[model samples]
Target: MPTPATSMNEFLVSLLRVPAVAARDVDDEGRTLVSNDVTGSSQLHEVGPDGTWRRLTDLDGVAAGRYLPGRRAVIVQHDAGGNERGQLSLIDMSEDAGPDVLPPLSPLVHDPAFVHRLAGVRQDRVLYLTNRRNGVDFDLVSRELGTGVETVLYDGGGYVGEVEASPDGHWVVLTRPNAPANSMQLLLVSTLDGQVEELTAWAEHTHQSTPSWLPDSSGFVVSSNAGREFTAVVRFDLDSRAWTSLVADDEHDLVGWVSPSGEHLLVATNDDGAVGVAVHPLDGAGDPRPIDVPPGGCAALNRHPDPVWSASGRALALTFSSPVEPLYAVRYDLASGSLSALRTPGAPAFPPGLVQPESHRVPTPDGEQIPTFVFRPADGGDGSVVLVVHGGPESQSLRQWNPIVAGLVAQGHTVLVPNVRGSTGYGRRWYSLDDVRLRLDSVADLAALHDWLPSLGLDPDRAALYGGSYGGYMVLAGLAFQPARWAAGVDIVGIASLVTFLENTSDYRRSHREREYGSLAADREFLHEASPLTRVEAMRAPLFVIHGANDPRVPLSEAEQIVAALTDRGVPCELRVYADEGHGLAKKANQLDAYPAALAFLAHHLAKGDGVTGTVTNIKEDTE
Candidate 1:
């Protein structure tokens, strides 16, 4: 047999952010599309309806590009400084031409307070939010494509997010952030007069949210946890002050765009963690008709607006993905309930010899049944396994794409991700079971998986634990709380000391942390008891920590404090901090850099074969 030129290192290159569908026009424009690959490095790949793909841009780090309305050109965001800061660029698709780097609306050197998400385009202008106005805070701004003159809009000091413009271009709707849970407030901003008006007051105990306006502009639709166990969509009667729930799911409901025809509503749901998209009538109690895309595990469903509507109100294009599947854009014909793949993921496919996941129920310490997903090597000849504890002790492990998991699996590691106690989609009781005093319950659920793994013939001694954010905190806690369970631990931006994490977080995040972990000042004893940093000496496994210097949620201090304590005790621990990252790695290059380092660490400490024989190297530097 011809030797496979692909090494374990090269097997994971495709796992990085390879583009599936690029710069797609609202409608098929002569079948013109843009996509990319790993080595091509984010350059636009033009695809035709016939499946022929060609590169349209050679620029390095072409962040994002989409078709411009009323024009034959494609507007793109480009990384000018090679430091992950992007500038707007234009690509004329009318001719077979590459992109042109337009003048930036802001300086390339200044770092953004957070990742920038693009709102819809105005007349030849792009509206975005940046920290230019408040320095420490963000503000809405508009930059004209004709002249590149940036105009600052509302000062986003107060809680403001998800900027949406109303129909007829008359008003702008934004979600205003209030302390505690995110309370949605609808604000109408006049484009002609520049006057702002408050449309609604803070709904009490109501998780506030405002969706897009109906095509008739009769009223705006908002989704919230009101009068329901899970989130539901409601139409707020602007004149009557009445709210009506249009649709509701048992535990998780996500409302997408209202059909342009004003007849149907598309909803994505987390029904016991099996996610799928559903279509329902505007006003009815009938069961919603569901369109099966991918398995809901770790998947996010998004419906596009202004569907082609070849069959009146039924057919449409949608995007879907889970942890196991990469993002894929597909055309769904509601009439036949059939899905056709419009775009497929390039390179970095799932590890070649990994088995498609098999789901099972594991019994938690408290006798609660937890759902678990296991992805093993195809041969199972490799006895080593990795238990990936998900973040959001409140968040469940659904089907989703995780480059880190893919990388380790490429090297013959069986990856197991579990939805423990406190995870959503299970039920209200299971989720709240891990709150505050019950938080240790999540660790117990992991323990159940540890005991259950050996029955599958995998070696427990070769198994390790890895997670980021809340998952990261679990890594340390798993070692501290149950030191004998894991061989090694990789902590990515995880919490070490619950008390310090809450006390030192940004004012914005500090307000929310109280709800999840309890108040640091009021619950000092509980905080100390739950903290991994306070019990670092109990950790016996080799440890690795990666943090973003600019992370505001779990600050760099979280990484520093734990590393300092472990090092002071002469424990084997390694830490890496990136200067320009935040809560998560934003830059694709940075992720590419970090994934390999993590894989090598796991292999060094946990892999049982030749992989552990000096294949892993640790490099550490002083961030201070």
Candidate 2:
């Protein structure tokens, strides 16, 4: 028998060994195609009804597999070095012919500089979104599967949020994001006549997404926050240009799916941070009935545009994970309302009774109650705490399977993750609280959370700030703005300077980021003022910085500039750069190297009586 994990490294090893199903899709034959990390690298794997897993690809990248309509083969989206520029390759499941990159779909196969997203692949045609034209905005394009003829379906500008085709293949719905404001509009395009009709007007602060067509093709269903504080299921009519609210709730955001037959719609709503599923009929006959979801965290049930309804429409597949549970591909039977696990590869081996996080509301000075999750050891902790802030200022800190938090808890440190004012799932007003000039308000909220930790018996002064991307920025901000509050900090691919990040980020993602952060041209002064680099002089805590050299979102320069400044100021700092990764550490090998180093760094600095300071470690570079 394998020995139980006792040390931090051993605990991390056991947790990371648990494979997570990143993306999954089911076919007509009940075979499930999943992209999992069972082989250290996230590759394509097929799971049969007998629960046997067969590896499909051995590539070293993140692969999201989806079976074609006829189930003859699968189309996999693969990206290299953690870059978001994904390419589509068709894999012949029968002959083991490996994955073949379609020439017509990917004209520049050798170049990994652009991003290609598969919208929908039918029998004879493939629709996708690409920024090949200007590298700034994604354009909707389609290619014939047999003849290799590529055609531009929509040449409209701005970021294409989603591209979905009708079941009949005569119409396509495009979701175009209007940035600098958290909103998007839907456009309906006809394939035969090339006519485009705008379904939604350009509205500020109104968010709309996940459009599913009705079986009859007369209209479509979408989740919209228009004229409401939370997202609601709304039905749109093509002929009358009318929108009717199908399901509305003041407290939750409704996200659901309309069956292929158009008889019933399944809507998932965010009850605070947890997911709740409700089924409603399309004919406006009766009240919406609730569908039972498995006890644990549901992966934002309504987040995906395409619902994973089985070919028979009797069952739906969903990916779910909990604080102690590894991600699993589960199937929920519509008729019986029963949820069964289809693939739980690494779950059984994981030790039971891990630390369960407790939800709390930390009140900020501005009268906002931040939703926070605290993970502590059974014996409380060693008094020191590590605050793990999440990215996407717009994203919420959900209860998911996170090895990093578990490892921190194993090391006798209390871990606190907070969903601050800007986090989603609370409501639109809460999400918009940290925009532009008010960005630092969210940072102040973090300070409030730090001040409130003492009430929970955690030592406030002995805390360390940890996060990546935007959260990484928060780490730097926590040290700079509230220097005396934290003992140390760790930032992974975070932004040191907002101005440089916005200017250097990929063109296609610039506007979407600008919507969260301020615009470069319009809010130049405010952007620079909110940057952590501007307040670097106030940073007294020792720091550890980790970044990917190939990071396209927050470039490597963000790490380099901050590290150089901290080192020159005689502040102790450590910098690690991985040449083979991007943004965050995606590959398991890189993660093993980075996360362990992070835990060690925190232990050395934030440990009870470690007062050692002013010793700078030389920059370490990993090319693995």
Candidate 3:
């Protein structure tokens, strides 16, 4: 028989068995095209109205897919070993199509050397973005499904995203990042003449959501934070080239998508971590008519399929992620106003004792109230806490499906999920706090949270830091810069050195990252001082690092250097490298291995042992 701790650990780790379903595209007959991890990796799956669930692809790694026009054939997007070099392919799903595991992927856009992003599938054509022409800048291209004729919609670009195509087939909107940091440039290109129309001045530096085009192609409905504090729904006219407000929220950001019938708008509000969804008429929404969800908080926008509505416009599909629940997809019927979960391989009736994270605003040293979520076990926390930071420095740690946070709470460990200084969703002002030379300011924000941890009954001395990508960098920074604050850390594909990362990262990413992290030519010294690797000698905490071998963004070298240096200094360090992964653990098999090991490692270091709770001091060596 295992000890109580061991049994609890095993049960928490078993939570990984909960399949995460991301339902995106819906066919004409109301069938949903989804990607789920039930088969150990994210693969294409279809959920029908009659309760029929079918897996479409059986690959060694993750895959993306969409239901084409008539469902005769489906577009498949796949890549090998977590390399971001995914290609677009087509699989026949018609009645005449013979069955052969995935129906044999017919090469649609097969260039292994370059990266291709599938824009979307329309009735007549498929649009995508590829850098195959120059290998640096992405060019928007569309291929006619019937004629198989390819046309370049726009060639002038850098970071030109391949996004949704217009319903009228005349225009396809392409996006690119512009200067001043955290803003975008949208270019509407004419499919026939290759003419382009730019929307918004890049100098505005305001973020915008997906432009939901009207069926008549007259204009688009989108949410933007231009000339305002919070993002609100506004319409952009193609004729007048002006924006007219449809809906405005005084406090929170609201994103709206026009329904398929073009009569209603599906609007969702980002109220801190909780999402409130409602439906408004296209003519003009008065008071929001709430579309009821599970109550805690609906999942973020990206969780659902684009457009977020059924082909008939009578139903909306969404994924719900709450502190007490693992992610599950739900379908909302507008006519009946009923919300139900989409059927999958296995859906569990989770126990009631699961903890719900409380939103706490921890005051930073500079008096900035950092938004943090405190998940304390209902039976009183074990005193061992883990401070979990999010990646993106641009992204927010929303109240959503986080298996790690859920597992940590299950194992009786207090988890602090903080949307530190640079996280989005708060406002534009909050996200730019750590930009350029002020990067370390965000790192200092973590120390404040650590010092304030004890007030919540969490043992500050017996705490660990955990994050991935940018958050991974934060984990390393907390250990290196505030050596006396953190007891242990787990870094997953994090940036080790700011200078080297900007230099060696993917070419397409370098310029984009430079906007926020400062340019190599301009601020090399500041970047070096800001890197966790620069203060490696100051690190004294035991660390566990996980990285995907094929990670294109942060790369494997970042993990190797920190692991090698820390271990060379005789400090306790554990490294797990997945040969078939990228930036983060995409495959369930790899996640099962890395996530469990990380939990165990943190648990051991944070266990209530005498003398283990002492603060970590810098490891000083006299090289004479």
Candidate 4:
């Protein structure tokens, strides 16, 4: 569970590789090892095997919780400098009564020049997938933890993105992209000889996500869009070269892990609009036994490692949020089948009547019903409002902690977040709604919300459009495409140019871009027409742009290019590029800086008579 602490939207959720359960002293330090988002200064402490957790580091950004091969503590730090670049750090908590010693493992891997993807650590060597050596692709490099000597196993061009090492570290799963349209083929690579074996053929347009190795390490499980509407679970045998489907449902299913007990496999499934965390058996059989946990909703389960076959099958930590609750971390006991809360630093639950988000559906111009989450403060039904757009165009807006919305609500403003069109969890039809040409539909749906806002007893003139990634792109679309609609906009790591965005993204995201935006080479004119960069001359609102220098998904150039254009046109715009951040902010300081910057921008533009005026040029480096 990320942070079962009553505060939802304290952070946003992403699909990353997380260990199902972490080993901690149950009697002393409790179960959770680190906070939800892997922030660097993450009060990241762990209960020693003897039952006590102590603070490990005092630096800024830290995350990517990797437990060393033989250590009882986590060993990776994310963006320690608030520069958006993650620094490798080793946290030693083996001592029962003292503060953990955390030392920087290597020079920080900052954006544009260096991007680190934590692969695996064996013996005293740490393996990382980095784009530092090659500008276009990633390379597997091994670094000795003590001496910091680095060795390249393979450059990213031949093999795929991050390599998944087998249990005994004898094999690795590599993702290979097929030509013509750039789809992916999952392959098994022999670590000793560097031999590649094709596991999944690129026969269709479908793709593969993170693949987890079974405890035996001889076989693995991958989430793929094989048969059903959503992604399905498939178990692959390395020796037999055969594959078996675990479960075929209309919803997408994520492989939590092959249980430590090997008897029950944890799976998070999106059944219709709701998500369920269930336990399934191996051997392609049995009905999925749903584990009763939480306040009746959940997603993103983090599993534990080691103790090979524990009676409890390790712990399952997940984030749960629903209509009645905000997002919080909840740990499920595999042995006792119990759920408990995990800690979050300063965030607290929204006081009752302070604000409550009501979920509803707004009809698009084409008769499509879009899901929307509206947060109204207690002061009055009428207040300044903002439309928070979610990224992905392919991603959905669930009931969770939205800092921007929550902050606005605290400042006596109402907030509206719409699932819009092309969001997931609503089936493939909804996801396909944001495909290139239909991109404007979701942007239009956001605009339509303004008309619906008044009916819900809100003010439209007090509205602003805020989003990151795809949501960032939508901010530009809403402002430039219709100049007078929004008073301000915030674009965080958003796509400004479809052509440049595709051309500049990392190899790992190449295939998914096609799945969402279509091919730039073939749809050249269409991409240019839809890109926000091409229409910057039409923008009229005050704009705020934040991007990570190392973002492989959208690239820092996206933000630079757009901000430069807006500046060239004399449009009011503020651009911030974190030196080490990628895709999203992982450091708490970055979060602290980002959230306040966004609030200040919105307040300057839309808040009633706070009266702080034009061209305020205060840009200070965040030291938090």
Candidate 5:
């Protein structure tokens, strides 16, 4: 990444100032609730019916909230200084409250030491998951809105993930890891009784969605791939204990949920890197009607527990973005088939000649075709190439809006985004390829991508590796393991030593992360060999590192040690740490500072001649 300069170009500043809506919730009255960055920092905002904007929570860090069913109150999840140990709070949105701002967050579930994730909302109660019991096992708990009373619904053995509370409040369907890192099991917990039952035949690594209830509350619908490769929507009936498939595709995965009226289901199909959405009838009698939106990138759902439908179930709201556009929120009406923006994200303006993503597959050494989304510079290919890795080794690189990639293209850097092995949205087998000791195989995918870049008229030696979290780990690993291929690298909130990261990370995360990265107890030797710090001696590419001081996932020390080791070896390194961020840069001011400098660094180092290296003379660290 580039170090800081006194000023940034006008186009880059415009790119940084572009606002986006990440997620949203729609109330019964057709009002929109969103977590948008128009306020500089991401906070909760309500878009009223009359085109007026109401600021909800003015927290320094990001505030995520959702509308409670049929009520004027909302449940907000907030955290301190980006530690990610979220606490639940309620803000009164009743008529008595001022439109200027809602009341200060009323503590609903406040314990800084524990993590409380809000799962689903019902009539007068909210369901959530917490680790407050033993700090290791997560329990399913629900709280009343008026009385503030609590009930621990399910405390099964251990490892409870996200769940769906039945509409009638009688049952809750659960999804959790069933030993294997890439697998999950579907279970049902009776809210009225204490009994827990497996929802399906026992199978390891079976993937399923959170259940969507039927109108009568007898059974539910879900997308599961228990006995097949591609996902299909299956309906389970409690009376007969029979399963029936409603919607499926031979080549693509069909994921959807039933509408409030149970008349139709909004189904999304994943084809490679593009998405297609449609509405299917529950009877499986009619053809699926396609939705009219952008062809490539569209999102009908968001992070909130609320359904995308309005209270009346007549309107559907979704947020959309692509490589050429920033994230914007929109609504679709069923009867009218009309689409409108809830509120235009920021100004919706950018430099002219923004480019679209081109889908390609780079062949790997092991003969696997790695799916990649490449963005070319509008000014032609006079500059260098950058390989942007998506984090979550579990996550795929979608065709979504990215300010960094757009800015780089504007500056003449062609960006290649690849979904290597171990990325989801493909299939179960593809998702588990790099678990534990197979970790280095994914790093080898990056080298193969660089080797194949020459086919597109790009120089393999002039390429750079850029990513965050797991992708950041790839950046450092590429610079170290394949030192001759890359001219520079940029890492953000990534891991250096898997062994140290597993040991120093938050206590609640160690066991969960151990499933992805090898466990220290059994795989210590392999962990050391796969770590970038162990091979830091061979890293010669100029490197830039960015991290949040309070990141609970990847510790700040991961950044400190890697930069220190490289500097001691006389390799040029620069580090920028955001004191008030975690995981990644959250606030716009910090991003405006960090990204510009990182881009400057890439522009300098990648322009060097053949075997011309050491782009920086001295190491620089910014903690201010």
Candidate 6:
């Protein structure tokens, strides 16, 4: 048993101890290769059929690991610190040798200056996307595993998203996102001639992704929001260019993967914020059947380089978690439709009966409904509230495991996580609602959330805004734009100025971010107006800003400038900079330090009332 004063930190430590399967792939022998954080940082791990786990790589930042086509070797992607400029290394799993830098067959293919993303692995050939030739956009390239000979497949500009090679090795499917709008186009490229054909025509404000070729190679299946309000799994015929809706719903956006045999498809739908899994037959003769997944957020691991189905097409692997549980890797049997845990990692069972969030629809001033998850203290009626806004204005606030939310609730604070307009789980129209100049409407949605706090028996004046990345930007916007609302704010790796962020971010990410935040060159004035820095003089809340010095997505300057401005005005502000981290805090030690400081800051500010003001006290800088 623990008191409220120490339970938050204890819970934070326990949550950090629970390891998560970041990326997973299956070998022919049925062994599951996973990337997890069992040893402080995310590293490669191999799980046997008997549920035994073995460490593979001890690298600092192993983002993901995938078994090669032959299964004897595994290719792992890692970056220095959290910089995002990743490099792929080949590890001979059989020999238990250290990872070796994949020798480049063509000097042009492996340039140290650019980031290399493993697209797909075929028989003795590797397909990847890189921005080596052009600093801005990625071009698809293929290389021979043995000779390292490389050839450019698609040299087109724009952001090249996920790429999948056909089972028969004749064709490759790739997605190119047209940013600022949610529109993306899929391309079907022939391996023999390097010719590319547009599978989905340019439709304004539409999104298409996660393409898998049919076993016969005559067509492919993809998740598309093309003329529909929500994304649906649709099949496209290469010859006739005919599109057929395979699995669709009026409410949920469907995402799925077709089995290698092409007889069945495993689809996951974004039903509000929770994920639901179902298996559908491709013959179209029967209704789709639902698979019983534990009540939580479920993600299909079928998109990995390895086969989704076991060698016998009997079992499939997936990762799942809930508000109380951390992430786990499980295998689902097709015959009995039963899920067996492969790897269940996370904090020990939360002393049963912890706070379970309830879903609510908070109505905005414009009458648009915003879906939110509210976590109340077990004893009930905590006047203090924390609004946790999610990043990726395009992403949703799902009912997933969050340490901060759990910690806040344990300490008798009510927590609200909202998915405002421009969030994806809602339909396509809802996703595009916060694009470009209309971005502030999402901020208004936050203000609406603050206004609704009182109805839940929580004090609006005692509330704080907390978030990271884009969500961090929202926190600043809420504090500055809605000055009188919050008592304090915690912005972790958030962007303060959209213009500076777009200008200073990685070249490959600029255009895509510009699509979401508006281009610096074109929308300069409008972007400046929307920036949190522009309204620094209006901030009434005490602020705690955290950032990674190596953050490539949202540069350190964003935090520095805002903190400097707030401090210059004689406002209460604290700044924490982690030297070895990029974007968000990935290291456990860093998180332990940062999260505790954040919780303490919120507790201190919320207790003093919204009118309390003080001078800048402490600024801490940490390095690995």
Write model 4 residue lDDT over 239-278, tens digit each, in one string: 8988888766764545445663456676766643356667
lDDT of 5 by residue, 418-475 (tens): 9988887787778788998899999999989998888888877789999999999999
The per-model lDDT (C-alpha) reads 0.63, 0.79, 0.79, 0.62, 0.79, 0.78
Q: Write the per-residue lDDT of candidate 3 for residues 525-562, one digit (tens) a residue.
A: 99999999999999988988888888889988898888
Q: What 10-residue stretch in candidate 4 is worst by lDDT?
A: 12-21
Clashing pairs in 6: 18-346, 105-148, 179-515, 180-515
Tens digits of per-residue lDDT for model 1 on 1-624? 111324655666556755444233333333344444444354555445555555556664445555566665666565532333345556555554332332222232234344343555644776666554443365666668778787665664654656766556666667665442324566666666777766555543334443666666666666666556676777766568577878776756554556655677776676655567777877775777877765654224221122222223455555555556665555555668766665543544443443356788887566778788787665563787888887776566766556666666667778888887777655455666776666777777767888888788888878788998999988888888887778888898899999889888865556456766777767789989989887787876778888877676788899888888877766677788776566756556676677667777777777565221221223443222
User: Model 6 lDDT vs. the true structure?
Assistant: 0.78
Cα shift from native, residue 201, model 2 (Å): 2.2
Model with the higher TM-score, candidate 1 or 4 = 4
Estimated TM-score for each candidate: 0.77, 0.94, 0.94, 0.77, 0.94, 0.94
Q: State model 1's lDDT.
A: 0.63
Best by lDDT: 5
Error of 5 at 443 (Å): 0.8
Weakest 10 consecutive residues of candidate 5 by summed lDDT: 1-10
Tens-place lDDT per residue, model 2, 1-624, is: 112234667777777777777446776565777767766777777777667767777765677756777746777777888787878777666554333422122232223778888787777777877888888878788877678788888887888877778887789998887743567877899988889887767655588887888988888888999899999999988789799999888988887667777888878777656665666887879877765545546654532223476655666777777777777766666778766675545454875547778889998777889889899877677898999998877777777778889888887889998888788888898888898888999899888998898899988878999999999999999898999899999999999999999989888888888977888989999999999999999988999999998898999999998999998898899999998788888787778888888888887787778753859975768766
| Model 3: lDDT of residue 549 | 82
* Cα shift from native, residue 166, model 1 (Å): 1.6
Clashing pairs in 3: 24-305
